[model samples]
Target: MDNLSRRDFLKASGFIAAAFALWRCTPREVTASVQPAPTPAPTLATPLSADDATTLTRTLRRITFGPLPNEVARARAIGLEAFILEQLNPESIPEPDILAPFDFETLEMNAGELLRVDPPGRPIGELMGATLARAVFSPRQLYEKMVVFWSDHFNIYIRKGIERALKPVDDRLVIRPHALGRFHDLLSASAHSPAMLYYLDNASSTKEKPNENYARELLELHTLGVDGGYTHQDIVEVARALTGWSITRPRRFFGGGGEFVFRPRLHDTGPKTILGQSFPAGQGVEDGEQLLDLLSHHPSTARFISTKLVRRFVADEPPEDLVTRATQTFQETDGDIAEVMRTILTSDELRASLGGKLKRPFEYLVSALRQTQAEIEPNRALFRYLTMMGQPLFHWPTPDGYPDVAAAWMGTGSLLARWNFALALAFNTIPGVRVDWDVLAGEASAPEGALDTLSDRFLGAPLPEEARSLILDFLNTLDAGFVLPALGALLLASPYFQYH
Candidate 1:
């Protein structure tokens, strides 16, 4: 495997030669994190011009969960464009290592089975655990990142009645597979998913009393964003067009039970107008289907989605040129997410926005796990911190999803919370989370050597002289029993680590 380049590794996984007759599974090797050399190669602390190094680190941070010790080496070896391409075409990559400790049974269960499960938190726990595990360990970092982004985009509360059951199924069938695929495909799938139907109360919608909850969100949140020029009448018209697009009863245990169902009897068979486009009387499910088609391809929708992508990848305000370029790519490519992402990742604006965005709490936790290479078997306590920081997975409680910028998360109290977790993690006191400081330290010893190792592993470079001296002075106050772990914790808690 060492001799094989990433391309060759993918090509050779099934056979020695393409013309040869053979079959094989994608090697389990593709899933696990590739261990770097015990000692990092001797290299300049900062190898490029200040701006270029900043851009490179920013690229790695945006694409991956966080920076790894060997991230720069690997990206340099492959070239940044090629690295971005690999992540964009994730099918060419193999499946990630399964979370062996997790059963995943509840996620796979039918809606009826999930609704019947007596205990509630088990499904939520499994889903959250899997989310953290994948972000920290999967080799296909970009794909996992997209899955998370979409989960938020189409958020549903796990504790909301039948949503506790429908949400996991929605994740598996609708969100994960299409996260990096076409926007139209993803939009269509979410429109037909049971969890969404129930959570938004579209299942109970009828021609007699149309529920505008799903329709309003579909226009304002899902496709055409709030400023996408939709009127209240358009929302009502969309509701009329979507009447009877719903799910079967959860009590049904057979056939397409608890699945999407269009009850023709409940559908509005009268003429309707959405965004000034008219639907003739006597139409049924096609009315809603047509509405989905219109919104997915609307020019406003393309701009809205593109703006959000640019904001997430580059900066909160988003550079106008990048947005213009990305919106053109989105409309030209018919919302090909991969191409849109490529446009943003390759842009000068994204590079220029270095260190401009702050890490969200969810990002902080996962980055901690990835940098430490901790042994993570999901436990209840591990997820409690997520709840505490107010970014609980699949629990945003509204359609807008969690905020992506820095100001929303900069409270002194939240900073203190992160510091506490960082110290606890390094001390090996966080239940079910374990870090191997001895293995991480290798042959490095004492204050100077340990700080060097910690900086190399976590920051990919040394800290400022003042910060380094501060940590060293603090170490002088501690005993041998606490010195090593406490120092590592201090590194994790540093302001540098807090940002990227």
Candidate 2:
């Protein structure tokens, strides 16, 4: 599949119009580890459907970063539910090949080891590079997708001092391990993560005067929905319950210092009532642990988290019926993430939400790389381009990560930026990345034949007739050498292509 020949290209051209348009369509199930979501907003574009191959490919488009042909084939071979089960248990999949070559220097480092390194090694850069590389090359697509979701849900700004070093370790230890495991596990891991402590100011929270930063966000943002019905006093009580849950900053290890610590002396060992539940007067670290337990199982937490999951995988408004069903799954299973994901993926809501999502800037960039099979490296180009496109990795200044709805990202400027990127990538113009024209073009040297292959490659089925004609007319004006590549670019930048 990687090396395309003239014969194969000709054969693929014949498949353009028939691959996805109206012909014997049937729906199928999908899997998790997908992308963004925010508070409910507008519904999405027209949902596309065709035959089994088309349905499977489109479903893969939802769960994975732009579906590679090989991934599509594997899904067909194994069948949907089996493949989703494998993705849910990423441990069953062999380790990704990226582990050795794309190594981030601080991946194995604890907070202390990272602090000892000179200049800090740009570990954040290496970590991000690895992340993008995995998006492109890893077979553990659903696992990687879940990591993206959890990373955003428990976001930590990398620009902060120690966080530059600590965030990568947090990704390695806390987030990735439990991304698809269980909600309670994910919440507890975030609470214990030194990076989270540092980012939220919980590290300095004390018994005498506790900080409310983490406490407020933990209720309003993390667990309960904004309207989840907690009061100011509840926030204060939650803050008091979290005192002395800090980092061990003493200079003990060679790499410098910082580990999760429970300083009993600094803790407020007083009676506390949170959400109408009482805590005994003298407890230690268990006070905070119990808080996590309470919040993770709360009815509001279940609904809040269920709504986000539904939005991320299904649609913008998140079907009321689906949210209620998923909430029950969350509560019934005690926050089992994998089961909840399966429930969401196999629902009628997802089947209706075929082409309903607008790709966020990050998804747009990463999916382009995945489709074009770009040879990306850890460099300033990705950072600059990602920033310019308006969704720099882990750089949202506010605690509420990048807006996941179309309204926030559908402005004229961001759309134009996306178009420019599509053109540059299709034309092989980006530095340090190569777009193989031969592999992309195949036997289609002329504009007409080129459109068939281009549509087949990018849009899965044939391009709609109107789009096909406009693209063909546009290609005719270009020089002979430019037609095939330009055809690829036009298809990528089209409005229809943006929704999936």
lDDT of each: 0.75, 0.75
Q: How does candidate 1 fare on TM-score? A: 0.87
Clashing pairs in 2: 25-50, 33-145, 33-146, 112-255
What is candidate 1's CA lDDT for residue 427? 65
lDDT of 1 by residue, 1-500 (tens): 22334543343232222111100111111111212112211111222224555556657876788867666676778888888898899887676556766666676777777766757667777778888888887778888888988887888887888776788889889999999999999999999998999889999899999999999999888999999998999999888888899897766344236789999999999999888888999999999889988999999999888988877777656777888999999999998999999999888776655444457888888988888888877777677777676688888888888987666776666765776677667767677789999888889878889888877667655665656766677677666756677777676766556554
User: Which number leads on TM-score?
Assistant: 2
lDDT of 2: 0.75
Query: In model 1, which residue pairs have backbone atoms overlapping below 3 Å?
Result: none
The alpha-carbon RMSD values of the candidates against the true structure, listed in the order shown, are 13.4, 6.8
